[model samples]
Target: MATPAAASDWIRYWDEASSDYYYHRPATGETSWEQPDRWICGEGYDSSEDSARRSRAGSSLPLEDEDDVDAPEEDLFVVRASLSGPPPLPAGGPPPLSLGAPPPLPVAAAEPSSAQREERRRRVLGEILSTERTYVAALQTLEKVYMVPMRMVADAGAKVAIFSHADLDTVFLNLDVLLKLHARFLERLEQEEASGHFGAILSGAAKDIKGCYTRYISNYAQAEAHISALASKAPDKHRYLEVCKSHPDAGGLDVRSFLIQPIQRVPRYRLLLEELLAHTEPGHPDEADLREALARIREVAAFINEETRVLEKSLVRQGRAFVREGELTKVFLFSDLLVYGVPTGRGYVQKGQIPLGEGTRVERLPRTEHLTHGFAVVDGHGKGYTWHGESEAETGEWFEEVQRAVAILAMVARKTALEHFTAAKAGCTLIKFNHRDGRSSPRWVRISADGSAICWGDTKSKECKSMMALSKAVALMHGAKSAAFYRAQGAKKDRDWLCFSLLFRGRTLDFAATTAEGLFTWYLALAALVGPRSSEPILDEEALRARVAEMI
Candidate 1:
């Protein structure tokens, strides 16, 4: 073989220059053409070497490196690399070995010329791949947040652009995509940096990214604020609380005996105010009343915020203990049906009077006199019995106290049921209903305009607050059913019965208020309209199906 110097010098010339090489410069730069501006190749340049290099410039095309079969892939970059200047013929080194570079006219030359160029092209491809991956990843993250979870789109087809978790990625992707485009535009900008149009592409992309990001954050903040407002509605929920949170003591307390006129007026009025506000256009000058109502809501919210904390705590404590005969098996455990004969210590009884607790400490299961009005007979702890009160039950302090005390029990029971059911995903959410009497039953039910969702008529009771929760829990779990709520009339007052029409029915518009009698009339009318459940439904379906079957 020729001396190594000859071969090395030959290849080095092309490896460093070729226009083809720069075009493919992977990430870093690489060269091609065997000509040489040996500014980089130092220490020994003979007169011949300089003369050879000068000839190697892009002009008098002498395809140097390719002649060597061992040439590297750098020929790719060299084709693109810009080049200029004289070819360098080395000094009295070894004989020239043509690595495509012009050899010393039969002088010793060896070695491949394209080694460095190959390295350069590899680097450039890597850069492109990396940038593409980063951009795509950001786009995917954004899509996940805005499209998948929120909005009713999953239930209905089509997704809306809104903030969820992945919305951030969308914002990032916009910026990234813009930058990539900008970069592409600027590559042509290098030569004409001073030209007015040089970086127009990049500037445009930058602006696009900025606008999209701002819009995203703006929408995200608004959505988060709305959700926060809903959570903050807790205090306002108290405006409907009709029961006295704490009972009036026998001394300084002057309990109101009649319906809480203010309570009824406020919540209903607030609803009206909401409607009025809803009607007001944002910029309208005729919005003074709306504005005042909004101010009231704010103030009311603040006041409710303080009171709810105290009530919530008391509610929790009340939910834990119960007063009953024998050992407490499941105190405060509210369920639609209590499985009789649960095996517990102190021996339990399914019937007759039984003490709620030990010693003179007792509670008899009072008999409920009326089915329309639910109650359990608890008379001095022997064998407990059940009693149903009538629509004509007595009113007064005793009635109220007894009812309120029973309601306290109901509240605890409701809390127990709500906790247990919700945790189990049982679904019927027991929200407390607004009731006028603290001493009356704690009103709780699932209502609809037809009272058809749970019941057919309103049945006010001194007992509903306690029994209604269970009625609803059972109805929801089993199917639709409704229980009437009758206003408690101390044995002295005439019984006020609720009508079916007044009771809300499932899915009907609850825009009208009907009395107990009116509600009953409506239900009778509805029953008449539908004929009767005992009669076959959809006579046409049965006849049509029979005809089709006969034809088949």
Candidate 2:
């Protein structure tokens, strides 16, 4: 066996020029291609001996001490023989070589115990309580710092310079009611939290929360608009607001900001409840209650979302107008439909509805001998009905609103059409309809994958027995006359309610739906495939699907 000094002298170094590892014996000043034996490579060397060896051979790779070199001697030889040069050194130390005990297996992160989760849930509940206190305090500031002062002034019948009493009422609509509602809400939440069983506090307040928040959120837009108008058009109002904002009790937030706190608070409750629910474990005492509360909050959120969507697609214009010199009518033009109704003591009783789609038309007519400010609406069947506005401006406004509704309706129709056509192309278009030829069972119909034909069969059959080429097909929802004809042909009375006809190659195929809505839906699907193509760019299919969902 080599002596200790000679063993320490065996330095392993990588040669860059030759791309191989070589061992150098400093004692004999000899370098060789062969790896030295375990004894010569310092199998029993200490740190100090290895350090001394490294100090002497400054440019060579450091030798491992006895504790570091855990690999079998033969394995180390095999690793070195296979490699062209010394392996890359890892950041922690030299390359692992079956190293001592293989470094302890990585310890997985410990999962939070039930006790820890309970602690986290309590902490979240505490956060919610603290935030509620802060919110209630803010609402109080709005009530005390602004609303009370303004109301007192108005009640004294003093000349309030900045804004009218009505304006103030509009700007702070239902705010006091909301403050009282949330104060009670906060008290109940506090009671539950104190009892260490914060369960269903929100669900318990579901009725008041939904009613009050819906009223407040619906009127929030009017409140904001009133404030914005005052700020821009009323200098005294703007100065008064600035002065009130400087009050110490205002906490650096303006009146508008304080007013929005309730709006913001609603959504914050949702998030906090969700976080608390997450930290809560199954079968915990609070779990069921917490879930119920979350559901109620989510219901409120959904109501708000739906109301916003409806408001977005609300009426464009509505007013009194004469229909072809008929009885005075209330005409309401919406984004996608035109509705006319008979005026009642409270509101309008709806009389009729016309969908403003591809075949709908509106035109301004020159002042007629008997009708002033006259315009005509040609229905999808090319029949014209005239209306007279109260004045030229009213008539012009009606014309413009009708034109806008028509354009918007057309865009929506094109998008729906493209979506239906694409779904049919993907072999997904399937609808069930009753045949007017006295078939006892409803037939399943689908547009062909290439959108060239319509196929029909019973649901029990895997294959369609009847197919019609759509290239020359025309689909129309049946009018009263056509329904009368179908009824005379021995169709059921229910068939007269939701009947439509498909005319192709001089042959007519009549179909009916169980419901009137189903009649319109089927007509729309068929019309989309067979209707004249639109000039607008194709809409994204996913976006169209979402749009359809919103419309629904």
Candidate 3:
């Protein structure tokens, strides 16, 4: 047999062929191959115009290119025969026409280009987008799945407030603000990726976020108190708890943990931005703005960290029975206070709060009821409260946690006192002899190293007074010009005495150092803190160390 025409040659012939075309009308089993004006499928066309019109009406597919217009449209369907074999010879006529194999199925794109990997600030911005999406999801979970049901109960005139409606509202409101704001910022960041001006844009966005979080951070304590109140005092708290337990989204969550996520998210900016800054190259256009943003974000993070600590310490585990009250009372153990409340759906109706402090005491109570676990806490007032947990282990845990919280509060109170002194330039303590209110009798005084304040009570417990700022104290220290000012006067004077008088808060306060070296030690410490030559004026531990070294 003569060599069959190559497939390309047959396809070329079909490409140039006119209206005389044929197709296998599989449905009707008929072909009108003799009619030049009729498509082989029994669809007749007068001209290309008719075919084009029908194509537009969706009756037939339209030709993709003008070159295929003259080829009878039905002939395209005849090309579906497996291309594995050559087209048939068609009984000694020209090789049968065939449409090119159907275009290869399009390969789906990998991942969307918008979500592709990014670099530098752009990558961090993408992270921001991702985290913001997560934060919004969390907010939605709390608001819709948890708070919404509680709110519905409240609206129905349920006297028992399941949660602190006000606190949740505030948290939800602020969280929504952050969520929506971040979303907008994410959009801007994405849109401006190629602009290279995103440094300023990102800085502005960070500042706005910090600003928005300011209220939430500042009011964190109140929010924590409210949450504890609601969890403890809400008469319908169990109902709320039941709902939370049954919630598909919140079943495994601790309400406090879920609620604190938003609080925690605020401080995370520093970490995220620091990473972005670390990756950013020096002298880059965004470097300055990124640095500034990092500074501001760090400041805000520090503040938020402090507030977060308070919130964390205020956490309460409720629904435990009170041995004293003979019923279950919500127990909120805060850093500085322990509160008892009745649970309501809206919030806890606080029965009372006992200050937790150095004076407070926690002890295990005798487990009288086999069903109950017990502990006793003596608050700062020395008033005793006995409570029960579900088990011995549970009550022990409560005691430990409360004791730990109280210890932390004690440390914090001390630190706060020192911080107050540090701010006033009197952080360091110096043992000296002093007369109370200028009385003749001299007693050992712990003069604030900066001489800004004085304390003269027992070493175990002392009262501190903010006499003046360090600046004024410096002037007073210099203004008093007498060796006797550094030495005790009268017949009671001793060789080790170095006395000084400070006009503190318009009252003359006398101080006498024990020895010459001790006098200079006190002098140098105060001078380092309040003196004009002092580089580090705060007289903190490092400053005190440096000052003592100078005296040596």
Candidate 4:
């Protein structure tokens, strides 16, 4: 058999059976013969349409070259046939039509030209191609089986039946590359075999695969290189198949924290609320109270959803009014609850400047102006939270209110995170919280039915992603600033200090760094500090007693 390099090099090829006799023919050399040796005929060549000229001895027939006709039937065979016996013969002589053979299979005999291969490739990779892996596998496997003739036409002296094996291997490898590679900038790298451009293509493919498979980046000149790299590492198709199956679902979008936040917070807060309400409620009936609370929740929910449907974009547009002069600010979830209504769904409030049209305008977010006074994010009761819209400067009797809000809101965030993690695993949305304003709620309160209390931070730290900092960020920024302003004028500072302390994880939070499992410890410490009367737990007589003993 011809080496792949030499076979592809020239227009000339020889009969492997007759080493000394070479047949210099067109790429597609066509002749009809019966029971011919296993020769790679000019399968791809267009046969001449002229009538076959027969050289017969009769005067009526065309005469052969008399000199060549008298020559003995000498076959210059290079490799002798391995068959042991002189078997069957037919009516014809030296031209070899004497041997009898059955007709060829239609699909096998219908030869494909080089142009046909190109057409097949284009058809297979068309725009509406199926991405279903199973279909891809079957189609690719079938293609490998069908390209036997083309392989022979391209490589003469190629083993007759075995030619398909090499063709199948190469085609399948190319398919693997085409299917797996993804890139932003792709340039086709098909080239002649001798120039060895496949090497360059392989290198480009490796970089492309790394970027596409690993991260979103610009890479790859052609897909071929990726196949070459994978081929080097895992020569067997099964290994490549395994890798393909294990890859992440490339078509789906990444799950963001928004959906996660709601689904998570809902169930966890429900459980915590159920536990808290069960312990705290008096055994004696209070149907009116539950009804009133449910009605209130409905009212908030409706208002939030309504504004969400109508004015969400306008509010988003006007959010820039919240940006202070040269001050950078973020949503501070509490602002979401009060001004717009719901971060998850909708809002009831319109986006108007503080002094009606006087505030700065915004077409986008990171609302900087009123940002300092919006909400706080923190962790309490062993979790994460956003303590909604309450200024930290709640001194002079309002101090008690800030403490109540902060403690409850912190528990809400923890439960939210837990609920989200759980729901994501289950692939469903379990919780729906409401956002609304509570102007009559002493300090500005925006409590969702769920436990999300978004508060603003007042510290110098501008962009804090910490749950604790977020819960109280608005208060820290606005209230803390107000507190400092007061301190500068010799105003009382007791309440502001307490708000800051509460946000810094209270006393338990202070000592929390030492514990390996500090989240629960902080919750216990905080619950103890907040005490039973304020919490008003509907405690199990036994559990409450145990808790009290532990606290002591």
Candidate 5:
């Protein structure tokens, strides 16, 4: 067994290395790869003719080293500065190069000694079987010592069942799913090992695990509610506790803790697969299967990340029931608001409303020696609601979900403020430029649709500001011409530069970008701002695409 720190290190290795994983959208029917050493700048870019030739040849751009195939998946968008820099060339031209076929695959490693590799594989299988057996034992303990006794007590006219049946159902359902899946896998794995057919079974391990994880995550919300209720709402739970505590087979463990074991075990698949991959050689028959499984399991982790993101946006599905202030409360979490409701004679009734914003705060409280899952939510007026969860996992989810929702609210507030400022000034588009109107050194300048451009000194110690009335301001892009900037050179004869001029009243402002793509973006944004409201100020497809591309 690894120490806690060692376990964390293993998980972090996969999490951080996931940057190399890229998902190809299915609809585009297009795929390409970019090497780290390549650049998008003029000197580093391939010629248009070469790009066209590659397209015609049906070849993908060189990808990262194939050895990284088992690395975790990457995000759809990467946030970083451009990798390209000024090329080593005289001002007039670039150096010649002979571009050829893509690089060959890396050489495979020398095979490990037979006995050592087989022993490692056997050890990995043993670990899997051991964990699976431990998990099965935990589930059996629940069914035998806990579930069976609870049913007996309920039959004897106790009110304990009323408050606990819903929770019991949830726990039993999820446990059943896990128990059957692992039991079958354990039998299959043992048989395969005996028959020396390990490759066949291991190949499909990831697909099977992926199916299980999908089901588990689907029931995550329900499981959380059930565990919370069991821990906090069970009436005279000491009766059931004494029953399980005194049982010979039971280890006197808290049932809530026992219930959370399966949830914790879900991520353990990644750890086990990592160990397996380390032992399997590149040429091993099971290597492809292991890689495929790793990728699929990584998808499961990715799904969790996305689900958390959606929770941050809003609780699209209704929130689960949580006991608050000694009553059942159903809380709906939205990016901008939280609505609390309680069961009433007629139906559920709204009990309170909390507007989450700049002033609202959600905090996780330090648990007491006895309570392991305490949290608090303080409204803008200082009114607070304290709550408890059944287990550490449940409590952590609540804390994170609320925090993410509040973060989304704060982000939306900032976005709204920016939009309002732009609307107040009747400006929609803005850009930064290096201005050399009169200063000896280039000054950083910000041009806005308010018919103005402000120039600031290198350290912003001095300022040059200009603005024009909306009625008189008009913006337009002009063709590139031979001109000397403060420090930049004039465009060469073969090169195309993007230059735009802003005219308002009697004053004029100029801006330039190095690439046509950027110039076109600025031109379109400015054109949209200056044009009449052909329809409305609401975001149409074009506006939405731009906003999503920029994120602000």
Candidate 6:
């Protein structure tokens, strides 16, 4: 046994039973089988004294002098075991050791070093290459077993009863293109991997990858629909597909299953690249390119998702309408949004979108001297927009669709609001709000857990500074802003727009939130306490208080 070298954190100990050397860090209570590099065996102490002590103890192990060792500093501390008991433990004693196996390292002490991170990055990159190869093989299987055979049969001028040439084109639309695109992509990835430049290859092929996948995914719905139709309507095609599943290359999957591979491939690439990027160091050469390639693939995947959402939405109506005098626009009424766009040579350029929600309003307007077939749409903020159509029937159709959409949206919103109110009433909801004075920091306001009272306090304080009984609160004036208030505070109208007031005991308390969602949650929780009159008659300060008091 030997004492730790001076100024070194590592303590070297000889285990007599196993005839092995072990190192321990007293501060972290970590034990390691490997000798720490910082331990200089005989630097701060007399080497001759140490050797004499070991000799007196009947130890046969030889201690190497620092001058005799020609090894580097990292290799200076070599493990030599002596048949001696363990070294004396420090003040509280060393952590218990089994000596049969190394102790589990503490999580805080086990952070991966730079070398470990680099190794992990290499492993993740290898995964990306391997998965891409497999994906390309799947695409090839689709083409060779399903696509090419159908085309060859059609070309032979035989009676193509299972599928028509037109059907083949629709079902296999752009799949060949996708196969070729991924095959080339896989080739490039392989070459880059071989060259030790795996991450740099994706940025160069982003354009082709995006374009091919975008085309393929957008038409994926039509292909799926065609397959579904054939499975139901044509038994012969179904039997043919059942037989195609038996092909060795088909891997026991039908045409539809193989068709879905291209759709899944882009997202797979995104996930693999994300994993690799996570392990890559910030300043590593491949970091920027990995990020860029990930962004491109993510963009393509997002486009496909948006297209899917649009396809799911039923188009209520779309036609030409005039928003202002001589400002004609193409308006599309979807299930949830009113999209107005300017018509271009190729298509429409989207100009704006109005979300249809609980507060939306649609009404018919009387014909004016300058405008005919008129209707008006009022948004959630009480702002009105007028649109005119060429004929009265067109205007009527638009008005009906807008009203139906608004009604449906309001119904859904009420259901959701009720659910939120129920939850807020059952449990505590906390929201932080900034004062309109702009000097005080934000404060945390919360409904009591029992749902009996509302309280306000500093952010970190455990106890509330002020409390008011929920039963005494008379009104919740939401969006209670005025021109005079903005002028007095020297603030813009949109600033603190989610401001509200709670009236209790003929006194008003003002609060404002940075986000609309926070305001809505507070409003719902308070409304659940005080009843529906909390939201009635959003008016000026004086009038709102009077109205709320009257309702009470």
**Highest TM-score model number:** 6
Among all windows of 10 consecutive residues in model 5, the one with the lowest summed lDDT is 6-15
Q: Rank the candidates by lDDT, best first.
A: 6, 2, 3, 5, 1, 4
Top model by lDDT, which number?
A: 6
lDDT of every predicted structure (CA atoms): 0.27, 0.55, 0.47, 0.25, 0.46, 0.57
Candidates 2 and 6, the one with greater TM-score: 6
lDDT score, candidate 6: 0.57
lDDT of 1 by residue, 430-546 (tens): 212112221122112233221122321112211121111111121110001122112223311222122111121221111111222222222222222221121121111112222
Candidate 6: minimum summed lDDT over ten consecutive residues — where?
Answer: 316-325
lDDT of 4 by residue, 418-536 (tens): 32223222221111101111010011111122222222111122111112211221111111222222323221232221111122222111111111112222222222222111212
TM, every model: 0.18, 0.38, 0.38, 0.15, 0.39, 0.40
Q: Could you tell me which residue pairs clash in candidate 5?
A: 21-73, 21-74
**What's the lDDT for candidate 2?**
0.55
- Model 3: runs farther than 4 Å from truth? 1-126, 151-173, 192-197, 308-552
RMSD of 5: 24.7
Model 1 earns a TM-score of 0.18
Candidate 4 stretches with Cα past 4 Å from truth are: 1-283, 315-318, 322-552
How close to the true structure is residue 85 of candidate 6, measured as C-alpha lDDT? 27
Better-scoring candidate (TM-score), 4 or 6: 6
Candidate 3 residue-wise lDDT at 412: 28
Q: How would you encode candidate 6's per-residue C-alpha lDDT over 337-361 as one tens digit per residue?
A: 7878897999888788677774889
| Candidate 4: residue 257 lDDT (0-100) | 14
Model 3: lDDT to the true structure:
0.47
